[model samples]
Target: RRNDPINDALWDVYIARSTDGGTTFSANVQLNDTSFVTPSNGRLGEYLGLAVDSSNAYVAFTSSISDLPLGDVYFDEIANSDIPEPGSAILIACGVLALLRRRRRK
Candidate 1:
């Protein structure tokens, strides 16, 4: 993510991947900008969230610095064979199930 208040309060996000590990990175691609927020702060940029599932990665970030009421979410999926270990998968599945069960009781 990159942002500059001097550049007309522009903020940009990019999704990158490297199959060869951290040795290389793909070109940056703009995701969203201040237009996502009405009357943008002209300094819209901060706070980022990133996550990944079995087949995809996701990113979300805030577009306003003051009186933030909403945020933009983005996602991308990559194809690869590097699967997680069975134990890790099981743990993640159990965690999700637990969360669901808890929500059901509410």
Candidate 2:
């Protein structure tokens, strides 16, 4: 997102994401805002990039002002699966132990 001033100056910019495919978005937090000091009169903007791999996804963006020519860039990565809940590791360990015992019995 971006806000442009009347004179074409950029003021501020923000970026956000949702791990659940946009069902719910994270806060519209400011990733970069050149006009942070004087927000009301300044402008803002953002450029977003997205990529995915078999196990992970990534999002990136940059925000800046017209005069600055360079903006802060940000990136985030998400795993394909939600983080396992508590006790999940114990269950996995038990399952592996059971398999090992079965193989030893044979």
Candidate 3:
């Protein structure tokens, strides 16, 4: 969940990928080019994640890009191999299922 840091009125969705076991992550990449805005009252309502196959990653979310007051559904996808890297990755979410196992210094 992102609130377009650049534009207060325009909301955006971004995702970051980690290739080195979460030690580092790629810079946040936007899912789609569509311009999205929070609901009039600023509630996203509901959204869900799709799946990541061997070659591609997919995501489904709700947005106000097409629908104004009520909002609508949308999707974004990227190839697995294209995922880049970041200086460091330390991502934590509320319902995170798993995290990279950090190595203990000897």
Candidate 4:
């Protein structure tokens, strides 16, 4: 979530992980790579959207960066060990496609 005032202030993005069925949460982990500063009349809305798959968690939000004049949408993905590397992912995709084609031919 982003906390910003009507005027300029330091905006931040954070993520919390839950391991015990939402009974408790870990400390917030800052996700933004660089500092986000609120621009004039900058409003980042209320809450962000989070999606967690089998091996990765995706966070989507909007932010007004320091250099950018306008706000931009950002997507960050945190992958676990189950996430395949680039090469492995590509190979898996190709294998799936090949299997689909063979099944269609039969």
Q: Pick the candidate with the highest lDDT.
A: 3
Per-residue lDDT for 18 in model 4? 48
How far off is residue 100 in model 1, in Å?
27
- Candidate 4 per-residue C-alpha lDDT over 1-106 given as tens digits, one digit per residue, 9 for 90 to 100: 2344454366666655544344544555566776565446654543355566556667676667645677777887866343322201111110011110111135
Question: Is candidate 2 or 3 superior in TM-score?
Answer: 3
Q: What C-alpha lDDT, on a 0 to 100 scale, does residue 59 get in candidate 4? A: 66
Which tens-of-lDDT digit does each residue in 12-71 have in candidate 1? 545444444335445444445343432344333334554555465455555543455654
* C-alpha local distance difference test of each model: 0.37, 0.36, 0.56, 0.48
Shift in Å, residue 10, candidate 1: 1.3
Residue pairs in collision within model 2: 2-44, 2-45, 3-43, 3-44, 11-42, 11-43, 11-44, 12-43, 12-44
Model 2: CA > 4 A from native? 1-46, 64-70, 83-106
Rank ordering of all candidates by TM-score, starting from the highest: 3, 4, 1, 2
Residue 29 error, candidate 3, Å: 1.4
Prediction 4 TM-score vs. true: 0.56
Q: Give me the overall lDDT of model 2.
A: 0.36
Better of 3 and 4 by TM-score: 3
Give the poorly placed runs of model 3, Cα more than 4 Å off. 1-7, 86-106
Over all chains combined, what TM-score does candidate 2 have? 0.31
Over the stretch 1-106, how does candidate 3's per-residue lDDT look in tens digits?
3454565566566656665667667776666576576667666534545455556666676777774568777776767655555512222221222232334459
Query: Residue by residue across 1-106, what tens digits does model 2's lDDT show?
Result: 1354464444343333344433544454443434422224243222445455455545454434344545455575645353231101110110011100111135
| Pairwise lDDT winner, candidates 1 and 3 | 3
Clashing pairs in 4: none
**What does the lDDT read for residue 5 in candidate 4?**
48
